[model samples]
Target chain A: MNARNCLEVLRKIKDVAFATVDEVGKPQVRIIDVMLVEGERLYFCTSRGKDFYQQLERDGNVAVTALTPEFQMVRLNGRARRLANQKEWIDRIFEENPSMNDVYPGESRYVLEPFVIDCGNVEFFDLGVTPISRESFPVGGGEVSEKGFVISDACIGCGKCLRGCPQQCIEEGTPFRIMQEHCLHCGRCFEECPVQAILRR
Target chain B: MNARNCLEVLRKIKDVAFATVDEVGKPQVRIIDVMLVEGERLYFCTSRGKDFYQQLERDGNVAVTALTPEFQMVRLNGRARRLANQKEWIDRIFEENPSMNDVYPGESRYVLEPFVIDCGNVEFFDLGVTPISRESFPVGGGEVSEKGFVISDACIGCGKCLRGCPQQCIEEGTPFRIMQEHCLHCGRCFEECPVQAILRR
Candidate 1:
């Protein structure tokens, strides 16, 4: 599936494991409800009085992962931009999640603010599919860079890197290419290359 | 539930969203399988050639959260200590997870290493239960410090701190007390305390 479809999986599985770095640089994670998924952007809400709110305000960088009942995993790494003029979104959130009213009754719900992740790197892994297919793509709008190692023209077709690759994703050809989709990006091939042919992307 | 039971939930869920800080201090999260659970300790394995293994080696500090099908979330924060002797456990891991053989055949399995979280802070939250029950406990050993704010005898029955508490967890008493479980720990009450009675733990 494409990046937008991957994000759609996040919307289907509303409960996501959201992670953020604390002031001390330790990773903190908790299950957060996905308030809304409009186009390629995903939105979430937290009270201004909560630590989660403070962490987002401080760092903005966050990672979210969700596992579907079918065993598919979608992980997104992005910066959480606080949505301005949240008056309309807050009402939308309350209307979308009525149970939230039980937690924050009446005007107290006004303390909640909405944050949106506009764009970032996303990895979608479908463990339920045969061969466990997976791919990484960019969400929203950005240049998506190939993450795994790439083979340069310096390769003499020695086949050493292929032997060293744990995933065996290297192909036999002139200037052997590493399969970006299957590569683990372990850097083993880069270390094993005699001519230093492998370049990390 | 207690610490042991919280860990049990993690084992039952098996796949957890594990969070680790990258070199740049941004939080990174992915789904990882719990290899084993002995007592309060949880063990996981990853190939030494992978970036995940390198990050753990660089900073053992990690956070793991798993949500059960019933909506129970178990979050554990702690340092991951690499096991010294892998010969014994590696064999056991392969024996327990036969599918791993398909991924890493023969001696290639030796690339994998096991890490254990022996002691940590664990929070058990069950949204399936009424009132959204939640509790925090220490796993393995050491003191279980109160997570949020604590009001000492210095409170002097002052109710000013109560007004500043966002969660309204503070109650009037001989010495005003903040409900540790419900406290947001935003330090609003601590800052507003007239007698400096609120202490963060």
Candidate 2:
């Protein structure tokens, strides 16, 4: 699917596991309530006084994974940029999420800061569907280049890269082409290329 | 309330969001199937060719979070050590998980490797419960030292720590003690301590 489909899956799974790196460089994960989805950007609020807030501040890089009821999994990896003006969005967040008032009641809501994952990589995998389909796409806007090995025209059809590919996604042609979707991007084919024709995109 | 309870929750929620660090220290998370649980140790399997396997092999540290249907969230952070001998566990994993046969049928299952999260920290939180109860404990074997600030005997009962605690878990006493269960571990008390009475436990 596309980024829009990924965002739809994320919205369906409102409660997601947000992963961040702590000071010690260890992976720290916790459940987070997704406040709202505005186009490609996903907004979430957290109290400034919590360790979760500190981790996000220290490292904007974050990953969020959510599994839908139908066993569809959507993982979004991106930098969490804090909104420049928190006051502008806090009211809208409370309006959409009325229950949040109980958590941060009245004027105390100011303690919560809103952050957005504007653009990054998004992967959608559906296990419930037959043959198990999975696709990765960029959210918001970015180069649409897939991160995998691509064989150049210099190839002599050696078939070396095909044999070395773990997923065997290489198809025979004048210059063997690597299937962008099925590729694992493990760099096996690039290493096995004798003519140095394999280029990472 | 305890490690056992946390493990119970993990078992019930078989699919969990497993987080690991990439080469650049960016957090990466994906939906992983929890193969089985042996006592306090949680076992999971992944193919050696996948980036997930490579990341775990490079860095044993990982964090897993899963949310139950009842709105209970369980987060487990620990080192994922590969089982010394894969032959002993691979077959068992396949046998236990019948659907895995479709993904890796016949001899293809050998590509999968099993790993275990032996001992680590586990936090149980239930938003469905009134007052939002939460507790952290060590799984496997270790001291149940809370990660947050602990009030030392040097506390002058100044009421400063109580005021600084975001959760308001500190109670009045000769030496104010932080209620470990409700602490967010934000280090606010440690920073606000005048006499350095709050030490991280």
Point to the candidate with the largest DockQ: 1
Put down candidate 2 lDDT per residue, B123-157, tens digits, no spaces: 88777754466787888864454555678899998
Write candidate 2's Cα lDDT for A17-51 as tens digits: 99998888888898898888877889998876566
Q: Which of the CAPRI classes, incorrect, acceptable, medium or high, describes model 1?
A: acceptable
Lowest summed-lDDT stretch of 10 residues in model 2 chain B?
Answer: B141-150
Give the alpha carbon lDDT tens digit for every residue of A7-26 in model 1.
78998888899999988999
Q: What TM-score would you give candidate 1 relative to the actual structure?
A: 0.86
Error of 1 at B135 (Å): 2.2
User: How well does chain B match by TM-score in each candidate?
Assistant: 0.78, 0.80
Native-referenced Cα lDDT, model 1: 0.80
By TM-score, how accurate is candidate 2? 0.82
The pairs that clash in candidate 1 are none
